[model samples]
Target chain A: AQTVTQSQPEMSVQEAETVTLSCTYDTSESDYYLFWYKQPPSRQMILVIRQEAYKQQNATENRFSVNFQKAAKSFSLKISDSQLGDAAMYFCASGANSKLTFGKGITLSVRP
Target chain B: NAGVTQTPKFRILKIGQSMTLQCTQDMNHNYMYWYRQDPGMGLKLIYYSVGAGITDKGEVPNGYNVSRSTTEDFPLRLELAAPSQTSVYFCASSQWTSGGPAYNEQFFGPGTRLTVL
Candidate 1:
């Protein structure tokens, strides 16, 4: 079974600071995809970033980036220069075989 | 484009009641998916469809059903509501590729919050 784990339930970061949300996944499939999604208080699920397992280079989308260590099975999301709008629930997911498995998610609080 | 949209932003159901969650996409995406997010938890896949008339079970399909009768619509049915079924339901759609599903980035709807008593 494919499983994604986000150990931290909650995280807080001061505005303009950087915060890294930890996520680890286990999958037998060699070729898969990893994603980080952000859900704001409005209950909308927004895609933050994505990384392909075959790619050695990490993925970055503006202020959001991923440190994807395939060998270690770790896919952590880093929010640089975090702003108040960055506050939300973050989810880590693994996609393989036409299915996606998501972690428990971490609630991010941006302190102004 | 509307991308993906789900009807009934919020609904409440009593035990043993039934309801259908409607989902639609305007992007002409061939892949549609239903997922439920429990409190303090990430989203769990309930069902998915690669195309019209073809649906498959996902990670958590129990007590839930889905049908894909057209390319634009995928409605999820709950035959009997239970408290355990209370969660925020999300509908997602993605463009299909011959290569595989890994390359597709799913677009999600605003989500429907369902509460079963």
Candidate 2:
């Protein structure tokens, strides 16, 4: 069984600043996928970024990027130039065989 | 495209009551999943179907049942509602391929909020 852990329950970032949400997982599979999902008040889950465990390079999408350290079993999400719209609950998930295990989630607050 | 659609955006049921939550996907996806989200807790997989006729239990499958009679529809049934079942349920679908990009990503529905009293 795989488990994802997000140590931070709440995080706040000033507008235009950067914020990083920490995530760690326990999995023995070498070939897997890590993902970060955002859920706003609308309760719609949206994909933020994804990283393949085999890839040494981190994954970056617009202002969202992941610091994936496979050896350390750590995958953290970094949100740059944070805006008010970035206020949401962020989830870290890992998947293999189409099944995903998610962390408890971190509530992000972008303050202006 | 409607993507993934879940009916009855909100519902409240008393103890021992039974209800079915309907889910439909227009993407013609072969894989569908049901998950429940609790406050401060991440989403937990309740059930999943690889195809129309195959269904499997997930981490939290107790008190819930699912059927996938058609490719587009995967409905979850609660035979006897309980307060512990109160949570937001999400329906998701993804195209399955032995090795492909779409296999890793899942499209999710708006979610249905259910309350059991």
Candidate 3:
């Protein structure tokens, strides 16, 4: 079975600063996909970014990027210039075949 | 387009009661899924359907049932609700190609909060 883990239960960052959220997964399959999803208080699950295991270059969308180390089975999300809107629960998810597995998640709070 | 929608945004159920959570997607996506979300625990897949008439159990399938009769609707049923089953339920849809890409990207709907006493 595939499993995802986010060690941090909660994280706080000052506005305009940078914050990194860590994630790790256990999967026997060589090919898969990694993702970071954000959920605000509205209970909406929004996709933040995604990384393919086959790609060596990290994926970046605006200020959100990932540091994926396949050998170490680590995938971390980096948010730059964090804003108040960035305060939410961030989840790391892994998908292979038709199943998507999610971590426990980290609650992020931004301070102005 | 209304990508995905779930009815009854919030529901409170009594123990041993039964209810069906309705989910509909207008995207005509080939893949649909039901997941339960708990605070600090992220989300757990309850069931998934690759397409109409092809449903399968996921990690936490116990106490839940699902059916995909059409391409657009995948309703989840709880036969006898328990306190443990009280959580937010989300309906998600996506398209899949044989090789990659689409297989990983999923569109999620606003979740339905269910409380079982």
TM-score of each: 0.96, 0.98, 0.97
Off by over 4 Å in 2: B99-103
Off by over 4 Å in 1: none
List the TM values for chain B, per candidate.
0.96, 0.95, 0.95
Candidate 2 residue-wise lDDT, A22-80, digit = tens: 99999866568999999999999999999988789999999999999888999999999
Give per-residue CA lDDT, model 3, range B60-93, as digits (tens).
9999999999999999999999999989999999
Candidate 1, residues B8-89, lDDT tens digits: the string is: 9999999999999999999999889999999999889899999999999987899998989899999999998999999999
**In the order shown, what is each candidate's alpha-carbon RMSD?**
1.2, 1.2, 1.1
Give the lDDT of residue A4 in candidate 3: 96
Model 3 clashing residue pairs (backbone): none
Ten consecutive residues with minimal summed lDDT in candidate 2 chain B?
B95-104
* Shift of residue B21 alpha carbon in model 3, Å: 0.3
Classify candidate 1 by CAPRI docking class: medium
A1-84, model 3: which lDDT tens digit per residue? 789999999999999999999999999777889999999999899999999899999999999999999999999999999999
Each candidate's interface RMSD (Å, one decimal) is: 1.5, 2.0, 1.9
How good is the docking of model 1, as DockQ?
0.74
lDDT, model 1, position A5: 96
lDDT per prediction? 0.93, 0.94, 0.93
